[model samples]
Target: MNLFDYTRADTLGAAVGAEGALLAGGTNLLDLMKIGVATPSRLVDVTRLPLTRIEEHEGGGLRIGAMVRNADLARHPQVLARFPAVAEALLSGASAQLRNAASTGGNVMQSTRCPYFMDPLSPCNRREPGTGCSAIGGETRNHAILGWTTGCIATHPSDLCVALAAFDAVVEIAGPSGTREVPMATFHPLPDANGVAPALAAGEIITHIRLPDPGGMARHARYVKLRERTSFAFAIVSAAAGVEVAQGRIVNARLALGGVAARPWRCLDAEAALLGQPPTEDAFARAAEQALEAAAPSGDNAAKIVLARRIAVRALSLAAAGTPDRMPALPASVFEGDVHG
Candidate 1:
């Protein structure tokens, strides 16, 4: 990696003020720098600060510090009991060793894992503004299917982010502008017409993710990720859900999808469809259909049409059954249920 000035901030203010590229785990940043994709004059390491605590907020919600490692968050009792989807996503990522090195804040801000964007030779608007996107007609099997524009088709790569959107988690940011809260849904940018490419703003450091009180319903959450391998690969299509059933009727349902969209996708149409309906196989199928109504599949990923639908249905079914721990073995055609706790 290129030489850069390193500083460990003593306080939040100091961390926010001493600027260059904000470094947490350096999982993504350092990797990019090593490959010459990102070269920074300075590296502000904030992991030493006291932001690693995970606490129970009032009203049964969760307040997670930005520096909490991915493994710690996934294994925490509070996360296991409350946000099973979030925990499952974290554990499903990388290996145990990488998770131990990855911080919660770093995961939230990790860049899109597009192959062409990272390769210096390829044309990518996200990497070099106005250069153009090579994924549009190149090896785009892993590109986005929804909310994509001509300029960018790269998908957001974080599974935990998808689950956060499902639970309506908001991020707390303390920066040069002072403290501000950003809803998870709006935290990632969507593909737009400007052709300026899609990405989060520079210099914004994530400090905490504020999880809204699940209100007795978080215990029944599920996360399902489909990948080429059984584990440790980015999702091909994933679903995260918070669902509750009362008297055989669906009382509440929240869903977020990943891999198929440019950002964490909240399935509002699916939520509306399941609000008063019975939580059954057919109901779940219909909800999945409604959720994917806006999907526009392209490139070699047309199979995602069926894959995404199945994950959504299965995740909702498991949530309605109130089983966060076990499920019937997933078929070979679908994902193996190993990473989800």
Candidate 2:
């Protein structure tokens, strides 16, 4: 095993200034380290820092500290009432025990950088420059169908990020230079952008996640994922959708997809399509078409393109139906909503 120094950071500054992997809950980091996928020489433990508060933001939204556990955030009264999609995304991930131990920031950071991850023995062009993406010619039934390049056909696996991206969540990051905020949509690398091989910038640590006021969309939002199993599984295709309907017309809409791209696939065109339209299956189908307009199969995963489109429509239809009085016992289940789309 590779040797590494371990330090428990007592302050946010100490965690930022430390030059290595920032350990929050260590749910994904520890697993990656054990498999030799991550070999940081130093582990900066940031769990004890005073970054666990969940408070109301100035914009009438919630400012969630990075260290807040997934379970806590999902169950927070404000989160459940105002941002049910975010809560549903959290509840759909892993299991009760894993959610209890996983941090909000860690879940965003845990998104995969390569399609062929979890196998350290495989060579990765993203991990080591010019090595070439192994998944390019290998198993791609579960790989990307959008925003993939010859260098990588990676997929982001964060369910929280999909909901966060749809609602314009901002990531508050701290570093030697100081703290700054980035929208969750841009927090991770985009398919067409030059991105870090490793997800985070060097020496920077996420301190908080700032969610904007959901406004009308808060009452009508949903997160749905098509996973092989009912629980503890990654999405084959997932969608987070929110719409503001007034006088039987959509005034605003937000749509984002996961398990299809390097980052949560925000459907700006899809959002635009839904605007001024009645909240109906026909409108959602048009938006779904717009969402997948740029998508192309990287390899043999052409079916994901069809599945992605269907889920976008499903999520939008469910969002228009309004959030449930209580979260469904089975998130992302077809049986949970009135309209399956």
Candidate 3:
């Protein structure tokens, strides 16, 4: 690893003003540093800043500090009792030890786990823009199936992001320009004609994440992850589904997909299809089909189109039945030998 200067910031202003990569838990940043994928001249430690609390907002929503550890957030009584899908998504990721060291802000800011991106010799546009993407024509089974360009097809590997999208969470940022709020759906940018951009601008720091009230859909929310293995594996395709039903018909629905796009892919069309419709297998299947209509799968990842639809239907069904506590197991047939890093 390259030698670098390190400083711990005791305040948000001090942390954001420092000229280096901000470090919270070092869960992802340190790994990237050791692999030579990220070489920072200095490290700004923000874990000591006053951003570790999880509190209820004035509007009945929740405000979670960016530095809050993943394990603590996942097991928080209010989070488990209200945003069950968020809790499930956080618990489904990584291992217990890693989760304990991963911060909420760091989780969303982590780089893609694509082998090409991590390997210094490989040509990955995300790692070095204009180098071209090796995953485009090499070992692409785990690549993206939606909103990808020839320049890059990498996917964000955050389970928490998918649930945040479903809940319509907002990101609170502090930067040189002062504080600002960005909706979670718009925070992560796609690498298309618009160009690749980090969720936060340079010198910007995430202070906290704001989650809107679920409106009684908390008990009717579910997160389903389909991975090569039951544990410690990144998802091949995952779904975060939340629905509010009345008299056997859906009143509101929120669906977000992960492990299949550059960011947490929100299925607004699917949600629209579910509203006012009965929460039946047929209805769920139709919504799933509508959700995948925009998919632009690469040759090797075409299977994701089918797999994502199946997972979406299953997740929605579980949510509609108000069984967020039940974890559904994926059948072996769904694996198809496509493992994620």
Candidate 4:
């Protein structure tokens, strides 16, 4: 890593105005710096700030501090009981060692895992705009198959964000202009016509992530991930699903796809289709179809579109079945249960 000034801040005001890169767990920031993807002249450590509490929100939901570590949050009583999908997403991320150090804010702010953007030698528009995209006609097996532009086709790499988006979580931000809240749905935007992506102001610190009460959603939720391996691997395609059923009829449904686009691709259309329908193979298949109605391969990733749709159906089916009393021995694997659901 390059030489940079470092200071630890004990207060939110100090951390906000300290400028430079806001450092928390250093799980992603340090790696970006080592590879030249980030070159901050100063590092303001916010681990010392009072943003580590996981308190109950006014509306019977959760207010998760940004500094809460992944492992702790995953095992927290409230997270496990109320937002099991969120806990499952956290446990399925990285490894035990990295999870112990990674923070909630850091995970939400992580950059894309596209190799082209990581290589300083490559011409990546996300890294150096107007330089062109190297992944255009190159290796794209792990790239996006939905909502991608020719300028960039990198998929977001966050399991936590997928579950957060599906559940309608909100982000709390602090900066020179004071605090503001943003719905998680639009927090990570898809590439516009110009392919400019993501949404986070410079030097703004994510104070907390507020999760609204799931109500009936708590009893039925699941996050299913398809990867090259059982653990410690980024998803090839993943789905987060929550279902609320009344008298055998679907009342509320949430579906979001990860590792398929620049952000967690929430399927509002699919959710609408599932409303009032009974949770069954045919209904889930139809909803999955609506979810991928606009999806087209950005490159030679046509198979990803198929795989993502199947995962969506699989996730929704499992969620309708109801959450397991205990987390699976292996979190989120298709093999965790029957993949052919």
lDDT of 2 at 47: 83
Q: Estimate each model's TM-score.
A: 0.91, 0.93, 0.94, 0.94
Pairs of colliding residues, candidate 1: none
Model 3: runs farther than 4 Å from truth? 193-195, 324-341
Write down the worst ten-residue block by lDDT for model 3: 332-341
Judged by whole-model lDDT over C-alpha atoms, candidate 3 comes out at 0.86
Candidate 3: tens digits of C-alpha lDDT, residues 1-341: 89999988999878876899898889899999998999999999888888877777876789988988887778776677789899899989999999989999999898898888899889777777777878777888888998888878888999999999989999999999999998887788899633367777788999999998888697999999999998888989999999898987899999999999889999999999898999899999999999999897764889999999999999999998885453333332322222110
Indicate whether candidate 1 or candidate 4 has the larger lDDT: 4
Looking at candidate 2, the ten consecutive residues that score lowest on lDDT are 332-341
Candidate 2 ranges beyond 4 A from true positions: 111-115, 191-196, 327-341
Going through the candidates in the order shown, the clash numbers are 0, 0, 0, 0
> Candidate 1 lDDT, tens digit per residue, 125-198?
87777788888778878778788887888888999999999999999987677778888977888766434432
lDDT value, residue 89 of candidate 2: 95
How much lDDT does each candidate structure score?
Answer: 0.81, 0.84, 0.86, 0.87
Model 4 regions more than 4 Å off: 193-198, 327-341
**Which residue window of length 10 is worst by lDDT in model 1?**
332-341
| lDDT, residue 310, candidate 1 | 94
Per-residue lDDT, model 4, residue 323, is: 90
Any idea what lDDT model 4 has?
0.87
Could you tell me which 10 consecutive residues in candidate 4 have the lowest summed lDDT?
A: 332-341
Q: For model 4, how does the per-residue alpha-carbon lDDT over 1-341 read when each residue is reduced to its tens digit?
A: 78999888999988875778889899999999998888899998888777777788988899988988888778777778889899888888899999989999999999998999899899888877788889989999999988888888999899999999999999999988888899887798776544555477765789999999999999799999999999899999999999999999999999999999998989999999999999998999999999999988888889998999899999999999999875533333322222111
